[model samples]
Target: MKQNIYHQFITKKSSGKKSFAVLIDPDKVNAKSIAELVKLSIEAKVDYFFVGGSLVISHHLDECIQQIKAACSIPIILFPGSPSQVSKYADALLYLSLISGRNPELLIGQHVISAPFVKKSGLEIMPTGYMVIDGGAPTTVSYISNASPIPADKSEIAMCTAMAGEMLGMKLIYMDAGSGARRPITEHMIEKVAQHIDVPLIIGGGIVDPEKAYLNCKAGADIIVVGNAIEKDFSLISEISAAIHSVANVNAG
Candidate 1:
């Protein structure tokens, strides 16, 4: 029902808090997951469900979104990796730019092509600056995206990129280590970036358990997103959500 998701979310139009959003890539999720995932996500109080992948080989995206939206009340946001991944069923989109890459296509050319369609669909666009960090293994996103990730140890490089993204008007900075990551972005990197940027920071990839997700939150990541872990074991969803949500509780007086 909301027309402007960024204004609403970043401006505290909903509440004065930024929330944790869960990423659900349809390509990685199995046939049996749609119904149960929606139920589990709701039960975990996840703030959103992100649907989309770099390559959607099937035209089942809309159906997937429909099924999940029908099963849950959480906002369905599209984390599209390509033009074909866009859909109207999702409430919003993280119109992402691979800022860490030098590829013009992913950096802006794709956005130019997809802009009109996204505008026509009336889905809220949440402009994002996406940075890929080396996760200790060659992951699907890294291999398919065809871009070199910023070295995991280079917090300075990450910081400058995030600052540049903010200056360029991106509302969110998502630092990912790539799916099937052998490692996740470091807490020190998270703290460095969080300290330098004003936008909501989103961290994902290699977060296969609650403690890892919570540690990222402890380092000031506003939202911790995990997808592959859930696809591998749905029962881990409740555990992860509890661990992540408890970060706030531990700090409360």
Candidate 2:
């Protein structure tokens, strides 16, 4: 079994360290691509691998986990879109609640149905408050979750929402712009949410470049997650990883 993954997050947050995670949608990558990604992730010294998508219509979830496990020891965290996405092969599962949306199903309905299986799977369950922010375009996450994102410019709303999630005992708070977003979440919004929450803040979606990753880290994101961009250009793993780790290095100096 993998070491406690949530504790790792807490430790990194407390120590002022930043992490980079590669998000792999099971339906998007095959064995060959997974092998390539795992190789790049190992070389880049990536901190984590977030495995899942908004709509995973494939049966490759377990296979994907196994492939990554076969090549490297980097922790695999299941960022599942639904109850059916769980796998015992992962080191942890981000049991997400869509706090930005009013949809009852995503907020709690799915959790109830997946509880027993998740409990039995032995995967470290990290309850997370997941918020979707407007990224200048409609996204699959917003459409599938049936929830409207908090407007991109609403920093106050994002701050309050993160505070509520922390108050409710969420282990982490994740604000995403959704896959293939036209714009990334603003640094101001990230700073606002980070200032308001005590738990680790995870920022994802539309981060396509090393500069954006670096800026997000400087804005107080504890973990920067990149998916579609990395899928399009696997070489980004090294560049973004370097950018995120550089923040910690600078802080240490």
Query: Across residues 1-253, which tens digit of lDDT does each residue of candidate 1 receive?
Result: 3446566556641232435667777766655678788788888888778787767777789988988877877888898879778888888889899999898898899899988898888888888999999999997667777899999999999999999999999989999998778989999999899899988888998999888888888887877888878888988888888877777677662
lDDT of each: 0.83, 0.94
Ten contiguous residues minimizing lDDT sum, candidate 1: 11-20
Candidate 1 residue runs with Cα over 4 Å from true position: 1-4, 11-18
lDDT of 2 by residue, 33-85 (tens): 99999999999999999999888998878998998999999999999889999
Q: How many backbone clashes does candidate 1 have?
A: 0
Candidate 2: regions farther than 4 A off: 1-3
The lDDT of model 1 is 0.83
